[model samples]
Target: MAVSGGIAAYKSAELVRLLRKQGAKVRVVMTRSAMQFVSPLTFQALSGNPVHSELLDADEENSMGHINLVRWADVLVIAPATANTLAKCSHGLADDLLSTLYLAATCPVYVAPAMNQAMWHKTVTQENIQKLKSHGVIIIGPEQGDQACGETGFGRMSEPLAICNRLMDETPTRCLSGLKVLISAGPTREPLDPVRYITNRSSGKMGYALANAALKAGAKVTLVSGPVMLSPPVNADLISVETAAQMHAAIIGKAPAHDIYIGAAAVADYSPMITEQGKIKKQDDQTTLTLTLQKTRDILAEVAQLVNRPFTVGFAAETHDLEQYAKDKLTRKNLDMIAANWVGRDLGGFDSEQNALQVFWKNGQKNLAMTDKNQLAEQLISLIAERREYERGNKNTA
Candidate 1:
């Protein structure tokens, strides 16, 4: 599956052939503009199957074409996913054929974005990518290099072969077999009313990265998420919430049933106690919008306090003084460990795929340097595996 208006949309035919050569089924779905770059007949000949491009085709719906196409796949991958396509998938805004399939797909979804360096760097685009990850959508790459648009930086589609290999590789690992995990992600919206709210810029990237990595490791993952404009990850059970209160209710509802819990959501620390019924009109004088903010329930802390709590982890996105804050959170929140990073920098941790980490635990500390979030996420999960094992042993001995 490929989205529209991307220069790299032309490479998808070769992608189809490579998959067929590996003895896997091949199907293609393209957006309207993608047809402008390449013909559906080209892909149909390559895959030996009809190419799908529309959601509203009366002929196909009569035969249940989209549902049939959706059920036919072990995985759906979007190569050269345009930012616009990414946005639709991120927030359940499925206004196109590919987006509709993404919403309707029961299998794993992978997106390889391609665009100019500048468009990729825009905060909106990056945040949309994070939202998709939070939804269990595995992001491949927009590798940094020279582009077809004569610009250079971080906006190239991962080579088709690389995307195909990585998709196939998900079947081998059973790293987290028999492990049940609970994860929370995104920024909790603290609502003043149905129309207004307070929230953060947490695009939910780190948590989603961890969730995808956990799945690749063979864990049964449950994601309790906030108001992120992203799609649900493929194969993950998703619980959606808006406010911190709602997030708390969802977490408390499920925390006891899992073997591990990672509270990665940036829950709003405070919320407005009173809200105007309608839009507050402008005032000439300095009108202090006295939002009587109240503290939100501490999700990780509550989990840590449980009688037989699962291994708990937390994330701290800081702007300065990383070491102190990370260590403090480790002890204060009583997390097994915490991952901290200095946000608001150009190193690309927040809305960017590449991220760095300063992890703190009672036993030791480690500096996880800047790398692709997917790679870093795998490393983080490995560490969690060891930590979880050690804690289990310690509990049994006690």
Candidate 2:
């Protein structure tokens, strides 16, 4: 693991601990600036090895630490990869030990970027990132959220557990190779007037994570997303929608060509029967207002009922009776699977980074304990792939 200079450098320490806990043999390499936020001794204690930060050290083999470190590593990871380090690597400048090691390493490389929101959105920084991707380096999160700089956007380093899970989920074999996946995400709005709308608390974290996981499994992905602050995963076909009706249309129109459809969006159950063209004005005598609501289309059920439906997956965010509600929905909608989790909780629900799920299908269920949404998404995708293959095999034999 390579740590660069940034406030997120502290997160790298936790990442090292997670990697160690997962039984990985970890080695730490740091840029000189990284040590400003975190001490080398801290990493040395977690990694159980001496930390490497200098490009040249007299005590090392042939006084060449970069070459030796590259040889010793099976994979190279740079967490909190600052803009400077990214630029250096992109331009093939190896003035520092971390960049030199990146150039020297033969193993797979992963970079998790962390910077201010403005810096992350800069054209030059994005270009550098694209260059790294073109060279086969895996880029992880710079997730959207509050940053140490008192601004909010896409510049936070992915959580330590999420980064660890992503590293662990990496495999040579692509499970969903050649498959096409369609996913819906985020909370759909139901407009009452030109200015006001009804929507849920969904943050679309899980859906985005699933899209990324499916992509990692080598599937071609289409993400039909509602309004969200997140940056869509690289290489996905993104279709943006704002309302439940629009989401329904997008998903229905695109479902047939897909091999898998995961309905992760929280579409509004109902919408105003009549939408006012202009904002409703307050009247002096009117203290109360009433409006009728009509049921919105059921996207999951419609997808499942298609003549040649894709393997359908649904999600149920319940406040109570999770198993009952989930199972009922699975049967009621003729879904292949349903993932249910408790909402209105202190942890692991809408708008939060962590989540847990009780996944159900006919005669089977699995409890995925609360964890980072990214990790959970990877597990769920694996399960979906396995179940899909099993069902296909059974059909062939029958």
Backbone Cα, N, C clashes tallied per candidate:
5, 0
All candidates' lDDT scores? 0.81, 0.90
Report the lDDT tens digits of candidate 2 across residue range 1-398: 99999999999999999999999999999888999999999999999999998899899859998888888876789998999999999878899899999887656579999999999999999999966754456789889998888999999999999999988978424688899999999999888898999999999888988887787677999999999987676678999999999999999999999999999999999999999999999999999999899999999999999998999999999988889999999999999999999999785889887899999998999999998786688789999999999999999999
Judged by whole-model lDDT over C-alpha atoms, candidate 1 comes out at: 0.81
Q: What's each prediction's TM-score?
A: 0.64, 0.66
Candidate 1 stretches greater than 4 Å from native: 1-172, 276-278, 283-286
In model 2, pairs of residues that clash are none
RMSD values, in order shown: 6.5, 10.7
> Distance from true position, residue 121, model 2, in Å?
23
Q: Output candidate 2 Cα RMSD.
A: 10.7
Q: Candidate 1 on 114-139: residue-level lDDT in tens?
A: 98889999999999986676555778
